[model samples]
Target chain A: MVDGIVITGAGIVSAIGVGKDETLRSLLARRSGLPGGKVGLSDLQMKTILGIPGEETVARSSLLGILAVKEALQEAGISYTGTAVLVSGTTVGGMDITEEHYLEMLGGEHPELFRFHTCGSSTDRIAAYFGGFGSLTTTSTACSSAANSIIFGANLIRSGRFDVVVAGGSECLTRYHTAGFDSLMILDKEPCRPFDASRAGLNLGEGAGFIVLESSAHASSRGARVLGRLDGWGNACDAFHQTASSPDGEGAFLAMTKALEMAGLRPEDIDYINAHGTGTVNNDESESKAMTRLFGGCVPPVSSTKSFTGHTTSASGGIEAVICLLAMEYGFIPANLGWKEPSEGCIKPESEGRSKVFLQHVLCNSFAFGGNDSSLLISNARDYE
Target chain B: MNRKVYIRAAAQISVQEPLCEDWMLDPKQLSGPFLHCIDPDYRQFFSPMQARRMGLMFKRAMVTSRKVLEASGVECPDAIITGTALGCIENTERFLDPLCRGGEETLSPTAFMQSTHNTVGSMVAIALGCHGYNCTYSQDGVSFESTLLDAVLQLECEGAGNVLAGAHDEITDNVARLMEATEPGGYPFSEGSVAMLLSAGESLPDALCEVSDVRILSRREAVEEAVAGYSAEYVMRNDVTFSLFGRCGSASGLAVYAAAEMIAAGRYSSVLVVNESGSNAGLVFLKKV
Candidate 1:
């Protein structure tokens, strides 16, 4: 197993909470961050309780990314040296502002907001906000973006390209996708209950999650605290449907199998599985099938934390990784929040609130549109030592 | 240094004619601020039904990927990676227009589904039935370079055989106007797709050029500082043999084509392709072995 790359620090801002501590507090308390009622959008008629804080009147994707990066760097206790490469992932990017000024360009108003419309604009903005960096880029693969960012960051370190890299993604709830998903009939009218018999669809949320990844040699030389080891990661394409997973979950199966092969571990070694339970009818069934196919006899305790944060899409992978580290640090498994019954032949998730388990190895899954599927295995640093 | 990566074959579809031959020899000069692709017979790649649903950017990606794979003589790649700056912006705008004016109910799932940044990559994979490692980068000027870095890592460290990597970007009328207003010095926006089939140099005996190194800097000024220490005197001897597109927004993959052309012609044993934006630059070095 490749063991040189480790996560030194992580920061998350979701509907559940702002910082890691607050998010953990809410997770331990079994709190649901989904809005209780319909929250009005600025221009569109749709009303979904997107995880944005009510006080964030000026909530833009780039601003949220900057804020999340600040928290991560602060927790890592590292000053801005402009040495680390920044790899950000996002889907909405600056659409929150771009949508506001779309007509202004046609009217010859030439507003400043149009500059942030590109996918890379958010990453560049974050870099500018944080002075500068050795390099900067963005990975945008729908929902699995940040997960791939972590994978790419680890590969960069392993390839001897750089010693330190900051990798994550930020996405904001935009009317563009909210309306789009509604057209696809995937947004649940009420709060989503993932992996349940009554599972309807997902409730889209917005936030950012970033982790400071450094080589073990680099971290130890600097006396940095080690959070967790990024043991392995895998990505695969379904090639079945554009927005739907295969009935048997071929993509998810290959991704999980590849990740296990990379980490040189069997299915029995995994202590927990953070299922990509999008609460959609197709995703839950397919993911459940994939898990069963891989872990026949001993299926690990699996759950979807999307129940708490309303499926942050691109940021889901990053947020879930941080949650895994918190679980390992505090010695507890996060509750699945909402689940009662399970589909036939599928293992039930840890639906009961706050299961106490000494976790060692955790698997986080993030599946996105166009059948883009990814899995990450983050192990406790102590286990490796 | 780790194992070197090679560019087996590369192809592009730009404002000029879509051919892997000497199209760049005497390129058609742009007459207008908006430079649209010269467009090939896309019907040759996709069926009528499929073509109707796909966007122009998606079509460009499909055609370029096919040409690249044919040139490389590889039918199925181990992995597919892509990068795009303005991914399906036309479709994005199409989906956003009615939603902004006519509310959320008046939307179709087709435009919305095709609007994702990764759609181009995923579509290519789906068509090829490739279920291997798939990823897409969208970092504007460095988007294509990011994919190249991933391809290199796959070949050198991750134990992958052949990888198909490429970039696609299309500027909508609205985005062109925005660029004009925001960055006046920016070139008139253009749209195209560039694809390259990459393999490990040790395994591919028929490779065209070896990719020695790829460097990405956070600022344009750092380009000089990074290259100052390099032994690039060979490059300095070559005059302005190629005319740059003149401040094109970010046709990053075009650099690979230029570097490969120089290596193939035996003009220089090594060529460096550098793409610079205001606050960023992506440098790729190619050597003929």
Candidate 2:
């Protein structure tokens, strides 16, 4: 692991909690932070709303992202002098403000608000706080964006370009996207139930997650404690439809297979699978088929933490990657909440949170519209043992 | 890092022309408040149903990418990467214009699905049945540079033989007016798509140019200091592109397209394409093969 793309530090803000300790506490308690799941719709939003006290004007996405990035850099002991490149993923930049004020702007009231609508604006805003990064970019492949950012950051290091990279994504909820999913008839009235036969759809949520990725040499030289290694990543286009996953999950199978191949690990090496299960009929079925295909019908412990945080959409990939690290760190498998029953062939997720099972390698899946599907494999620090 | 990456082929649909390098000889002199990319006849590429369902941006991405792959003699690229500032603004408008007027129940699934930034990239992959590395970057003006950098990494580090990279954007009448009212540059908002097939190791006989390197920098001062080192024979700045094809996020990508055309025609031995958004800059180095 010391010669791999090791993650030195990770931070996240989700509906469940603001940081690692609180998130792990909530997960161990099997508490669902989603709005529709045993809570009011708008009452249980983000875990902590950032007023940041003395911060200037910035989008909520950037605000959340800044908080996450600060915690991550602090943990990694990264400062402005480290010359770390930042690769952030975000789909809705300032849409939360734009959608709310578009009509008024048409009448020439605060037209400057339109400037913040670009997805890159949020990345730039986040970078501005670090006094400027060595380099920065934004990825926006829908829901799988954050996963792709991590993949791209790993590539940058593997290519011998940068020593340290800050990779993750942030997203804020907006009425426009919520209604968009609702228009597709995919928003569940109740909490979502992934891999369950009676599942309806996903509930929308918002948050940000970030991880400090450093070349193993860079991390060791800086004396930063390596949490885990981002062993493998694969991104493939389903190419089946704009929004719907193929019935056979062709893209998902290919992605998982590629990740396994890249990691030089067999399918059986994976201790757990963090599924993309959006609680929709299409996703759970397709993901199950992919898992069955790749694992040869003997799938590992499977669950979707989206069951807790709802579908953070673009941010889910990064958030869940952090969740995977937490699971490996805490030696537990979080329960796939909201499941009542399963179909005949679908993999049944763990019903209750389990403790004392140290995960060696875990796979995380994130699928998005336009057939963008990505998978990442993270291995614990047992590599040098 | 020692691998030689070549621009095997390039195609673009813009104000000057569509899928042709004829603009190198007789460039179009066009001025616009909102310059829409000219679309060629789609009867040859897509079916009636597809043409009806897809918006202008999708068709542009498909046509340009298809044209690039064909010109490069690549049946299917190992990866398809694209960049766009606004995903599908037309479809987004289609979904939102009515929603603003009628609160709920008037949602268009088609519009909503195609409104994402990756839809164009996804459609291109579907057209080619390419299941390889797929990505989309939306980092404002440097979106396309981000894509080209990824393509470079895929070829050099990931052992990919060929990569199809492109940048696309479409300006709507509404967004054009908004830019005119807000943005200080009277450069006129515009739209276009530029796609190139990049290959590693050996160069093809008819390759357009060699891509030595590409970079995207956050600070303006760093770019200014770095430009002195390359000493390219010719440089195409943001102002030049702004005047040529109006303004769009992918205009920097268009500069890459234009540089390739110039190098292929022997106009310049080396060209450095530079574009900046505020202090951020994207640089693409191209040279005659």
Candidate 3:
């Protein structure tokens, strides 16, 4: 009924790599981008931290995002000439810089640090960098940021507002995020083991991912290679807690259920699920309960890619979506690293380097801090053929 | 598949004192470069310990959401959706202050944890324990309208009976100073939160208005597209009386303001309000039953 919004191209820049191919290769090999110590921190308190490493070429999030979008546009074979860009999703957005400048200003009278207040201004910079100026938008919905961006982009296409749209999210490592997670007592010093009985908390990661989506007609006319079809998406709020998923994952359940319903499919029609396994005790358990309620005993092969890339926060869904497409394209399933010994009443994710049956339909879940939950359904483009 | 959704109850906290009954429709001019909400005593609504951790933006959002819920007489809503151009700016500023000033040592955790843009909506959920569908949208000017659109989608596609949808934007010294330095020609700095209780059916007698449709468009084509897509003649025939325009952010709210003005002048029977600030734009049509 939607005439199908096709994902013609996708790109990703994570702690692992700066392009889709590099990221996938790293994920397939079970490589970790998490360093033993933090980068760019000079003080002793900053030691013993792990994150993605980069320099002043761009803000960490923006750099990763730009790398991803570059690859995505190339893969789509579209030149960035006056295209519409919509960058939706959440992040501290220049808070990394803002925090640094606030200190510098307090210590002395450094006037150069005032540029970070233009947090959302980075979207414009990205768009301009890509030679795009049609319409630019940014959405900040916590973890579900990029997923919501994708949904809004698709809606714009369906509404006949744009010919081509670039949508996704990005987040970068920051001391502020680390301190926040630490405050909640949810920062795991060890590599996060999602859904593990002994699971403790999430290990923060940073990256960006994006997809070039176009109307099916537009894609076909340009002879662009369609990676997959964005069948449907749904978003819901679990009006439950500030930082915790509901006991039953009501919001997650509704988002997934509604997405499938909109796609005109059922649970049996799904082949795999990319879970929002943040390795946190609360998230894994609640998401598992929600999956159980929705799929009953017939839950499909499920895994959380967060183990490989760390929790990318806003970019989690976008990166996961790219992984789903790659799985469908290559006929393989990436492993969920650090997952072992499933928790009580939870399904165990496929171990590292375990290949699954040929995937046809994949569901990706992205849940954020505000109880904002979003689910996206991606299926092989050949399915409709 | 287009369906009608009505705004049964509404609450707003703004510089004009829109929340209190005594301040109805009495517009106030903002004197300073920055205009903050005449905030109600949030202490009465939230516990100090809980409030101790929340930023001013989240506190305002919680208070406004509670006011809307109480006015609507709904113990729990089916969903909670919020939109904010700058989410938890105060918290972000607070979290960064110590790290920058104290050389990244002895930093506080509370500010960092609550600094994310969705904190307001998340805190609202924690306060209510509703366990329903809750999401936050942070798309610049159209943040609130995007939230409203999602609420409508819930009603039409997901069978949501009642939903709480709202938008809140707060002004912080950091944000105000930055805006002043960067974009000197932008609208005066303002902070406010508005919430509405939306129901599927005509369950309330005093339902303020019904939302007919909502739209988001590019600034370049907004006027032409709005005029073409939404005909003044059609609106006139449908008994639309006025429109509320959000002229602050590139006049993205102009469409609604024009519609509200028309309705207020008795030129039409219904009205529309539109707002666009930050990075997004939205239009909402209201029909008087």
Report lDDT per candidate: 0.79, 0.85, 0.70
Model 3, native contacts kept: 0.47
**Between the candidate structures 1 and 2, which one is better when assessed by lDDT?**
2
lDDT of 2 by residue, A1-385 (tens): 1248999888888888778787788899988887542212121132234434443446778877877888788888887722788888988887776777777776778777777888888899889877889789999999999999999999999988889999999887877788899889999988888888898889887888889999999888879888889999889989888889998899999889889999999999999999999988888999899999888868999999998988888888888999999999878998999888976557788867579998999999999998899999999876423
lDDT of 3 at A336: 73
Kindly give the stretch of ten consecutive residues in candidate 2 chain B with the minimal lDDT sum.
Answer: B177-186
Cα lDDT of model 2 by residue, B81-114, tens digit: 9998776888887887777766677778788888
Candidate 1 lDDT by residue in tens digits, A1-385: 2347888889888888777888898888888788421122331211113333445323366666766777788877778748888888899888877777677756788555676787688888778767778888889999999999988888888988888888888888888888888899999978888888888999888778899998888889899999988888889998888899998999999989888998988999999888889888899989989998999978898888888888888888888888888888887888886688876645688896455567788899999999899999988888633
User: TM-score (0 to 1) of chain B, per candidate?
Assistant: 0.91, 0.96, 0.82
Error of 3 at A16 (Å): 2.0
Runs with alpha carbons beyond 4 Å of true place in candidate 1:
A1-3, A36-59, B203-205, B233-250
Q: Per-residue alpha-carbon lDDT of model 3 for A1-385, expressed as tens digits?
A: 2377899999887767667787778777888765321222232211122122333323545555666777888899988546565655657666566666665454444434544433355565466456555666667777888897887777767756567888888777777777778778887888888888888888888777899989899999989999998988877777676677888998899889988987999999998899998888999989999899999999987888787778888888888899889888877777777777868967788766456457778899999877888999998877633
Better of 1 and 2 by DockQ: 1
Model 2 alpha-carbon drift over 4 Å, by segment:
A1-3, A36-56, A383-385
Instruction: For residue B256, give model 2's deviation from the true position in Å.
Output: 0.2
Superposition-based RMSD of candidate 2 using all C-alpha atoms, in angstroms: 2.5
Q: What share of the true interface contacts does each candidate keep?
A: 0.79, 0.73, 0.47
- Order of candidate numbers by TM-score, starting with the best: 2, 1, 3
Over B83-162, each residue of candidate 1 has an lDDT whose tens digit, in order, gives 88778888888898887776666687888998999999999999889998999998877788888988888887788878
